[model samples]
Target: MSRSALKLRSWPLTILYYLLPFAALRPLARVGWRPTSRVAIYKSVPTRLLSRAWGRLNQVELPTWLRKPVYSLYIWTFGVNMKEAAVEDLHQYRNLSEFFRRKLKPQARPVCDSHCVISPADGKILHFGRVKNCEVEQVKGVTYSLESFLGPQTWTENLPISKTSFQDQLVTKEGNELYHCVIYLAPGDYHCFHSPTDWKVFHRRHFPGSLMSVNPGVARWIKELFCYNERVVLTGGWQHGFFSLTAVGATNVGSIRIYFDRDLQTNSPRYSKGSHNDMSYVTNNNQDGIVMRKGEQLGEFNLGSTIVLIFEAPKDFTFNLKAGQKIHFGEAVGSL
Candidate 1:
C-alpha cells in the first residue's frame, strides 16, 4: 500500500486514540477489557502484514514534503512532545521513523544525582521493589519468576545453583534494600530511554514475544507481560553488581533501537524462532563495550513503550517510591 493510503487508514485510529483520554467512561470501559492478551486474533494476520510492509517503507527515501506529514501523524498518534525534543520543527525530521525516535535537548533532562539511579525516561512508575530470589511481583498478589523474566539460559548462566530454589526466598527478602521499577511511557512522553546508572554495555539480548498493549490494565492481566513481550534486554555490571534494563515493544510499535550497539540492528534477523514470532538475539560484541554514565541515552522505542529495570541479588539501594507515582527523566529512582 502507498504511504497516502496508510495515512488514510491511520486517521480514524488517530482520532479514536485522542478521544480515549478524554472519555468520561475510560475507567469503566477498560474494566471489561484485557489489553494484554486481548489480541484481535483475526486482525493479527493483516497487522503483521502491514507491519512488514511499513518496515520496508521505513527504509525508503522520500521528499521532505511527503515525509513531514507522515512523521507528524506518528508524533500525534504517540503524543510526542516536540518542545521537549532537540529538534523544534516537525518538518526538520526527514522521515516518520526519525521523528518517532527523536532526541531531547542536552539540558531538557538532567541526571538527578551523580550517585543515584535516575529514571530512564519520562513515564509513570508501574511498580518498584526487590526481586526476592527469582520472583518479582507482576501485580497485587501476582508474582512471576525472575527466571522466566530473564529466560532459562540467562537464569542459568547468570544465577547458577540458585536457579531451582530461587523463588522460595521471596518472603525473607521483602525489604527496602532490593529494588525493581517499571516505567510506562505514554504517547505524549519522551520516547528516548537513558541509562539509570553508570555501567558498561557488555551484552544485549532481544526476546521475541507478543505485541499486546502495555497499558496498566493490560499489565495487570498479562502474567509475565514484560517477559513475554518483544524486548531488548541490556545487561551490564554496575558498581553494586549486575543490572539490566528491558525496552518492551507494544501493539503497532514496530521496532526498538539501541544507541550503543550496532550489532542488534545490522546482523540479527528481525524475527525469532519460536511460537511467539517475536525477535531475539544479542547485539555484536566486536566493538569495545560502550560504558554509559548515569542518565546517558541507552536506546529508544520507536513509539510509546514500557521499560523494566532489574537488579541482581545483594541489592544495596533504596528508592523513595510508591505505587502509581509519576516519574520524569533524571528523577531520583534510587540511591546506592
Candidate 2:
C-alpha cells in the first residue's frame, strides 16, 4: 500500500488500539480498581497474544515498495529522527524489529567523560531519588516494594540497614543505602538502553507477572505496577555499591533482548499463567565477571517499555535529577 493508503488504514486501528486502554484504564484508576481484576483480559492473556503476534509480524519482510509507506507511517507516527540512526535509510532494515533496534551514529550520543552516574536510556525520568523504606516511587504518591518488585532475588536478604523508617521492613540494612530511578520509553524514543556507568553484571533474575501498560496514567492507578509486570532484573555493581537494572514489560512489548544473554526472553506464553512467579527464573552468575563500560548497550525493549535502576552509591553521591525530567543514554544524572 502507498503511504497515504497505509496511513488511512493504520491511523484508526492505531488510535483505537491505544485509546481502548486509555478509556478503560483511566476511570478504573480513578476509582482505585485493582489492575489485575477483570482488566486482565485486556492486560493479560489477549495482550500477550497480541504482543507475540506483533513480534512475529515485525519479522515478516515486505517488499521495498510496501516497506517505505508502512515504515514511513511508523516513523511519522512516532516522530523518529532517521538522521540520528546509524543507518539513515529505512530500507536498510529487513524488518520492523531491525529498525526498532537500530543503533545511532557513535557521535550522535556522546558519553559523559567525567566520573558521574549517567542515564541508562533515552526517555523521560518518571521518578528519581532514594529508595526509602524498601520502596521506590512509581509516581509522586505511588510506590512499590523493593523485594516484591525484584522478586525472590538473594540480594533482598542482605540489604544492610543504613536507616530505619518502615516498622519491620528494613529500608537499608546497616551500611548500604539504596537509591533509585525509573525511566519510561515512549514509542518515539530510542528503544535500546545502555549501562549508566562502568559496571559488572554478575547475575540476573526474570520475574513473570502481568503485562499491563506502564504508561504514567496506568502507573498512578495500578498498585505495584512495576512489580506486577514481567521484568528482567540485572544485578551488578560499581566500586561504590551493588545495583540492579530492571527491564519492565508492558502491553505490546513482546521481548526484552539482552545483549549478553541471548537466551533471555520476556513476555513469553510460558510465563503468562499458572505458577510462573515461583517457577520462572533466569539467573547467570559470572565469576570471571562481565564488565561493560559507561554507555554500553545492555539490552532493548522490543517495543517501548520502562527501566528501573536501584543502587547504593557512595556517601558523597548526589542525584542531579528530579521527577519528570527528560534524559538520554549518555547524559549525567549524578556524581559520586
Candidate 3:
C-alpha cells in the first residue's frame, strides 16, 4: 500500500480511541487542550493495552518472505542504515525490540577514554548545561527541579533529607553547581543507552507517573515534562562527584528494562491498578555498588523515550555538546 493510503486508513482507529475513552473519565468537558490537561486524559486511558499489542506484534515469528516487506518498510520510513547495526541482515531480528537494541561492532563506536564524559545514547541532545539553584532547563522558558527530578524530595517514605544533602556526596564544587543533560530517543534511533562516565550506581528510584508523549512538540509546551513522566532514576558517584541518570517513559513505550536490575519493571498493571502516585526503590548500601565503565550499556527503552543526566563535576569540567545536537553513543560530550 502507498504511504498516503496507509495514513488514510489509520484515522478510524484514532477516532474510536479518542471518543470512547472520554466516557470513562466522566464530565470530560472540564479538560482543556492544554498540554498537561491533555496528558492527564492521555494517561487516564489504559494505553498499556496498546503497548502490549505492539509488543506482541513485534515478537511474532514470521516467515522469511513475510519479514522482508515489514522490515523494508520500517527501514525506509526510519532511514535506518543497516551498515551500522551489528546484525546487518533484516532476518536476524526476531522482534522490533531486538532490532531497536541491536549492538554495534566494537569499532563502530569507540568509547572515549580521556578524563571526560561521553554521550550515553544515540539521539538528539535536547539541552545540556549547568544545574543552577536546583533547576535545569527543559526548554526555553521551562525548567524542572533537579532535586525533584532525581527523586530525593518526592521519595518521602523511602528517603529522608537530614542535615546532609544528597548532592553533597556527588558534587564537591564551590558554588553547589551540578551539570545536567537531556537526550531524547526518537522512533528511528537506537534504543539502548550507555553510561556517560565511569561510576558506581548505589541506588535507583522508579517513579510512576503519566506516560505522556516526550516528543519535542509535547515537551516544549508541557510543564515539568521529565518530572511528570514515569521514570527510573539511577544514583551513584564517580571519582569526581555524584551523578544521576533518569530514564523517562512515554506513551506506548511500556518497558524500561534495566540490565543491572532485572527486577525493575515499568508500566506494570499493578502500579496502574488504582493510582499512578506509587514508587519503587532499591539500594546497595551494603555493597560497593555496580561499577560501570564509560559507554557501558545501562538500559534500554522498548520504544523511544528520554534520558536526563545530572551530575556535579570537579572544577574545570565542561560539556562539548550544544542544544539540539545529534550525538552517538560513546562520543565524548564533555571533558574534565
Candidate 4:
C-alpha cells in the first residue's frame, strides 16, 4: 500500500474514534440503552467454560528452568509477597494452583481470640452491617436479598408459619439481629478460607449460576451480583441464632471446595438456573451436623473469590472492620 493512501484511509478512522466518545456521552435512552441491559449481556458470557479452561491452563506444569521467570512475572504483576508464603521459593510451585493455594507462615496471620468473629479469609472488606429488610449490602449501596442469597429455609421446620418476613424469621431470640459481612478476594490474596466463628453447619446449598466477576468495582455497578454467581452456602446455628457462610465463585475460579463435604461439587456441566441443590448435614447418625471451630479451615477456591457471612448476633454487636480495608484471615471482624 502507498504511504499517502494509508494516511488517507486512517484519517477518517481517527476522526470516527474521537467522535465516538462524544456520541456515547449522550443520553443512553436516546440510543435505546439502559444500564440494566448490561446484566443480560454479562449473563451471556460463557464464564463457566472460560473458567474451566483457565483452570486447566493453571495446572500446566512449568519447565524447571522457566518456573522462576513465569512465576516471578505473576508475582510482580499481582504484588504477591513471597515472604509471607510458607514456601518462599518461586520455583517450588509447580503450577499456578500451588502458588495460589500456598500456605502462609504459621505466625503470619494470628487469629484474634478477643473478638467474637474473625475474618474468614485474606481480602478486602467490601461491606458490613446489620441486614435490614432481609437485604444484605453487596457493597456500599448495592444489596441482595437474604433469602435469595441463602436460598429458602426449607431445612428448618416446626416453626409456626406466620406472616413474619424471612428476615424476621431468622431472629430466633429477642434482642438478636442478623448481621452480614462481605469480603472480596483479589487474585493475589490467599485462596483458602477458614471458619469465622464456632458454628454448626447443618445444611449446604449449592446454587450453580453465572461465574461473573465479583470484583468490588463490578459489585458496585451490578445489583444482585452475588445472587447470580455460583455459590456454596453453609447454614447452621451459633450461640446467637441462624448462621451462614457463603463462598461466591468469580470469573476465573472454576472450583469451590469444602474440605469437609466430599460429595459437594461446583461449576457442574449441567444445571438448572434459579434452582439450587440442597444437602442436609443432619442425618440419622449425626443429629448436630458438622461442627466448625473458630479458625478451622473450611473450604478453598481455585483462585480468588468472595466470602459472605450472614449470621445472628446481639443487637449490640459491633464491627472492627471498615469499608475497603485490606484484611487478613483470622483478623478480628466483630465482637459483642
Candidate 5:
C-alpha cells in the first residue's frame, strides 16, 4: 500500500482500538484471548501452530520482486530511514519479514563505551526517567506501579522498599536504581532487540495474554496494557544490579522470539506457573545462561512491537532522554 493510503487506513483502526472496552477485554484475555482468537474453529488448538506456520514461511527464500516490495511497504509504514540503517540493500534480504528486521551494519550503531547503557534497538523512545518509588509515568497524570507490572513474587523480591515521595531524589543510596525506558518499534523499524548492558541472561519467562494494539493512543487509554500484554521477559545479571527486558507482543504480530539460546523458538508453549505445575522446573532446568555484550542482538519482535527496560532498586544511572525521543542502536542510553 502507498504511504498515504496506509496512514489513512490506520486512522479508523486506531479509532476503533480506542473505542473498544479495554477493561472488559482483560477478562477475555485472562481466559485466553489472543491473535488467533478470531479463528473460532481452531481456537481449541494451540495458537503457536499459526505462529509457527507464519515463522516458517517467513524464512523461506523468495524472489526480490516479492520480498523487496513487501519490505519497502514495512519501511514506509514504520518511517524507517534507509540511510541510518547498516544494511540498505532491499534486494539482499531473503524475505519480507527478514528485511523488516534486518541487521545493522557493524558501524551503523557503535557501542558508546564499556560502562554506558547502550540502546537495545533502533526505534523511538516512548518514555524514559527515574522510577519514583514503585511508579513509572506513562504520560502526564498517568502512572503505573513497577510492583504491579512484575507480578507479586518478582516485584516483592526485587523491590522491598516503598517509594514514599517522587521528589526525594530519584535514585537513593540503597541499591534501588530508579530508571526505565520504553521503546516502541514501528513496522519499518529494526525489530531485533539487543542487550543494553553487558550481562548474563539468567532467566526468561513468557506470559500468555491478549495481542492488543500498542500504539501511543492505545497506551494512553488502556490501563496496564504493557503489563497485561503477551510478553517475553528476559532477566539478566549485571555487575552491581539486575535488569529486565520485556518484549511485548501486539495484534497480528505473531510472536516474540529470543535468539539467546538456539533451543528456544517463538512457537514454544507459555510456561508460566498458572499454565503448568512445574513452571520453575522448566525454566530452571533450561537455565543455560548466556552472556551478552552491549548492543548484541538478544531477540526480535515479529512484525512490530514494544520493549520495556527495568532496572533494579537504587539505580545509579540517569537516562539523558525525554518522551518521544528517537534512539538508534548502540547509542548511549545512560552512564553507570
Candidate 6:
C-alpha cells in the first residue's frame, strides 16, 4: 500500500538494479577492456562464501598421479619457482594447501640485517612513506583513516594520550614520525608473513569484511579497499615507538592463520559486519607483549593477500623501495 513498499515489489526495477553493472561490462569485455575493481557488481557475488569454499577445496587431496600435473599447471600459470621450495618435488605436497604453505629453502631468502625494517612477505610494494594528517595511502593517491585502520590507541594506556592530538598519541617519543608500507602477495608468491623488525606484539585486532581482490589495480580503483576487506591488525612496539602489521584477506583467500593465535578465526560462515574482535598478548612472559625478532614467522594465508606495516620512526627515516617494486620477505623496506 505504501510507496516504498510498492517500489520494493517492482520486479522490473529489481531486475534492472542487479543486471545494470553486468550489462555495462558486456561491451567492455567484448572490446577486451577489463576492469580490476568490480565495484559496481561487487555486492552481486558472494565472495566471502566462495573464499571459504576455496579454502576447503585447497585441503582436498588429489590423486597421487594427478598431483604433479595439477601443481605443475598452477606453477606454470603463476610462475612459481619450484627450485626455491624446500621440497622441490611436487609430489611431496598432498594437497593445494600443502603446496601453498610449502617452506622455502633456508638460504633462498637471506634477511638484510643492515636495515631497520625488512619486508614481511615476497610481493610488490604498493606504497610506502610518511603518514600525513592521520591518513595512510592505500595506493598512490587513495587514502584511509589511520585511526579507523588500526582501531583505537587503547592498547597504549601507559603512554600519554589524553591531551595529545590523534596522530600525536601514536608517537611514543618526541621527534618521531609514522611510516607505512603495503606489500601485495600474488598467487605465485610465498604465503607466509614474518616480523619485519624486532618488536613486541601487544594486541591483535581482526576486522572482518568483504573478501575482495587486493591486487594493485583493484587498490587503485577502490579507495580504502584494505579497510573494506577482512584484515588482522597486529599492533606492537619496536625501538622507535608504535608499530603494527596488518594481514588483509582477498578473493579465494579467506583463511588467515596466525601461528601464535590459534583461537583467532577468519572468514566465518556467519558474522556481523562493521564489527571487530580484539585480543591482548600481555602476560607474565610478555609484560608488554609477544617478543618477535626480525624474520620470525608470524602467520600465513591460504593464498595471496596483503601485509601493511605502520610504525613510528624518526624524521630521518627513508625508504629504500620504489612504489610497485617487487621485494622478498627478508629484503629491507626502509632504514635510518
TM-score for predicted model 3 compared with the true structure: 0.81
- Candidate 5, 39: how far from true, in Å? 21
Model 4 pairs in collision: none
Go through the candidates in order and give each one's C-alpha lDDT.
Answer: 0.63, 0.73, 0.71, 0.84, 0.63, 0.84
In candidate 4, stretches whose alpha carbon ends up further than 4 angstroms from where it belongs are 1-33, 158-163
Deviation from native of the Cα of residue 164 in model 6, angstroms: 5.3
As a TM-score, model 2 comes out at: 0.83
Residue 312 miss distance in model 5 (angstroms): 2.6
Model 3, residue pairs in steric clash: 170-242
Q: How many residue pairs clash in each candidate?
A: 2, 7, 1, 0, 9, 0
Estimate the Cα RMSD of every predicted model relative to the unseen true structure.
7.2, 5.2, 5.5, 7.9, 7.4, 9.9
What is the C-alpha lDDT profile of model 3 across 1-336, one tens digit per residue?
789966764454233222233333444446544544655775566656566566666677777776667766666655567788788888887766677677777688788787378888888888888776667887656888766677544432322344265544345545445788889887667888998888877777887665766777667766787887788888766776567788998766768888888778777665642233323333445455688888888889876789888887765778888888888888888886
lDDT of residue 217 for candidate 3: 61
List the candidate 3 regions with Cα displacement exceeding 4 Å.
1-40, 153-176, 272-286
State how far residue 143 of model 5 sits from its true place (Å).
Answer: 3.4
Model 1 lDDT per residue over 1-336, tens place: 679876775555544222222123245447684432243332143333344445556556668778767666656555556777898886677665666667888888877774468898889887888766566765555567676665534321333345245443221233323357888887667878888888766566666665655777656655776676667777655665566787887655557878756655411235553323222232465333567888877778766778888764345667767778888889888775
Off by over 4 Å in 1: 1-50, 54-80, 139-142, 153-164, 167-178, 265-289, 313-316
